[model samples]
Target chain A: MDGFIFSLIIGIFIGGVCGYLGTLMLSRKMALTAGPLGHLTLPGIALSLIYGFDVSLGAFPFVILGIFLIWLFETRTKLPMETLTAVVFASGVAIAFLFLPVEQAETALIGNITRVDIYGTIITSILCFLIFLIIRKNYHKMVLINISEDLAKASGINVRKNNLLYLFLIGILVSLGVRMVGGLLTAALFAIPAASSRNFSKNLFQYTNLSIFFGILSSLLGILIYKFTNLPAGPLIISVSSLIFLISVIFKR
Target chain B: MGKLKKQVLKMFAKDKKIILKVKNLTVKLDKEEIIKNLSFEVKEGQVLTILGPNGAGKTVLLKTLLGILPYNGKIEWKINVKIGYVPQRVPFVKQIPISVREFFLLKTTKEEAEKILDKIGFEKRILEKRLGDLSSGQFQRILVAWALVKNPNILLFDEPMTGIDVKGKETIYSLLLKLKKERNLTILLVTHDLNIVFKISDYVICLNKYCMCRGPPIKNVTPKTLQKLYGSKIKFYAHK
Candidate 1:
């Protein structure tokens, strides 16, 4: 496949899955959490740029480490997940700035979707599909936990295990998302489409399905705009999603 | 043996089947004791009401019994027990876009959820309404229906009538009684309503930080026990 086709395919897959996951995060009142987690992927992105490896591969370990620490501290210290994520991601960004080559900084920061080959596209698409399936299976349990931990526990759902799995999934998404939107705008990939969908959706089913629809729509539109305008795909994608959000707000009943 | 003594012996024999046993359950959050060395037991198919004022750790105790919180004691349930819990308030329910149907389906299949809703006399159309759009009373009923959909043998409720009006509260109370009778369910309810304590509960635990009085409400919950539990004067009106 051509660079344009490869980028388009990968972007669609990532955006759709991220948007679907975002519905759960938004419902749990943790929509903005992805922002800090996105930032946490920077050290890995910097390493990837330095070692000449795939950005997603380089981003994976750091985000996983950050997620593990956040999960550990949340359980041990009884601190909120967002609070721990903020602390961890700030440190990650600081470390990333220390070694990030100035020449490759732009690519590391805003991402270059055109750099991926067909192999990378296939791998990412498969990963997105797997993540989507996992989230779909646990969606109701996570929602129940958000509603009431006691209720979830009474229903024989393992709250702690589910929480850890959720954090791990977020880690995986952040790592994969950094390849498309870059570390800075990865959160927008998840948040904006879901937020827009919330305006028109009357129920969870519609909310999730609409979120995925908007995700793919914004991603494809952004890549097409980038093809003609030479603007960065990351910012373009976020901008398109943001435009949708604005229109949603205006048209909200 | 005398006739009364024989009846008492038979009653004791029937109560021998204990479904829950808690010994010295002490819960501490942030190093501050919430429930201190409390002990209680629940018989199968009985209504055990937990009564106390605000900040009295009623919610905490219920959470501990559900194994949601760390507690330093033995909380043993009968083997193969299924519990359904209705929390005091789902504070974020208003912000969520989940429809009532989705909420019910979280714990059960659509057919089971519909059956429970029907049994509760709820309009089937209400299933399409978003959780955020329901009145507090309606939400409370939905919570109850959600609990029942799982066919739990024990139901635990924390201040289930927090935002319900007087008439709504009566409806919920009667519904609870009806459900218990129909399903042979054991209930562990935490509430502030003295009338409910006296009227429906087979056993009452007047708790503050500790168990103050625990027994049949008609025999054990005196005016003095209420004052001690609440740390203030209480106007007692027995509900027959």
Candidate 2:
């Protein structure tokens, strides 16, 4: 019971944070970037496992580095973000295979929410809430930047600064999420809720709020189901979120 | 000789206060010089229209002047002056739903957004309309309203009326003219619409990669100036 409850709490926090960040990413059409970045955390996780360190914290630096590479290429090379993400994805997988023990790869890829301790859950939840508050406060600013960089600059909003800050925050959120969703399935937590909410949201506020709602719901429900059925929590949560997304598309309000 | 000198100074003087000055400005993207050694001055209450055809660096000049793009040389705005800008259009991606009100509220309050929309002749109901659902003309006006809410001393536009119909263009043009007179607002409008050059310009700067000619529309915008800027004979019948 205690383990189930812990898993549920962690799932909700990770899921909600992913969903909120997803809104910003999806606005920039960066869905592809999120998933690949999740995979890129593999070598970090491998190193953490080898060293007996905290895997999520260990994965943090690598994901942030991956984000920096994407941002660097975006500004300097002007290559499409998709192309940049692909380069990172290839390099990340290769690096992971080199360091990752084959026996542990399954657990690393699929994720095990049972591994998160109480301190880890508490810290992650607090971080998730903090990111939510910041994003909520800066919602309109984010939209303006997404709408047009030139217009935002004229408004005295530092478009580049805002973009980098958002990307940095994304690196943090994605890192925190990797432990629960595993690297492969974490992207769905970020993407599915936002995608579903976008179909019916009348304004930015609703779009964002509903995304968080669906994200929490998916995490909570998926965890409960995992407790009863012994299925992997990460894929089950993503499946639940995807089902909601499909239903939203079918109804299409 | 003193009288002649005074006459020449009077002929040259644009206004009492120079609102914006671009001196020997150059913008190079990659290897290509988009704008080269361009110089101009805008006064506090005059409309400065940058006239050029497609790929003539009109938009480049506006971006450079707005300090959105890096460029060589000096861009000086009078102290305490605020700037507003309207792009040709903001891409309204279908995936993310954003309302007109939410967009305006990015820079101002809901009440202020509604008021600005009304001032720009958009209906109050438009506040609830999704930005993606707006027609081209409506979208253009919404952008104008977006900039107007800031109450900038100077407004810069880059092809503000692109994709808007003729009537919509006339409406926006007149709205801008009204803004200039009523508020004494300085405007930098970039356009390829030679047809409306005579109609909207207080001053015209014809540019290719360089300033071909610049002065009051009634004087500097001549057939020779057009030929120099566009590299061809183009007839522009002055229309009221």
Which lDDT values do the candidates have, in the order given? 0.87, 0.82
Model 2's alpha-carbon lDDT is: 0.82
Residue-wise C-alpha lDDT for candidate 1, range A110-199, written one tens digit per residue: 888998998999999999999999999999899888887777887779998998888788888888888888888888888898899999
Q: CAPRI verdict on model 2?
A: medium
TM-score of 1: 0.92
Which numbered prediction scores highest in DockQ against the true structure? 1
Chain B TM-score list for all models: 0.92, 0.89
Instruction: Give a tens-digit lDDT track for model 1, residues B71-114.
Output: 89888777567888889978777656899999988867888988
Interface RMSD, one decimal, each candidate: 1.2, 1.6
List residue ranges in candidate 2 displaced over 4 A: B1-15, B92-95
* Stretches of model 1 off by over 4 angstroms after superposition: A72-86, B1-16
Share of native interface contacts recovered by each model: 0.74, 0.77
Can you give the DockQ of every candidate in the order shown?
0.65, 0.62
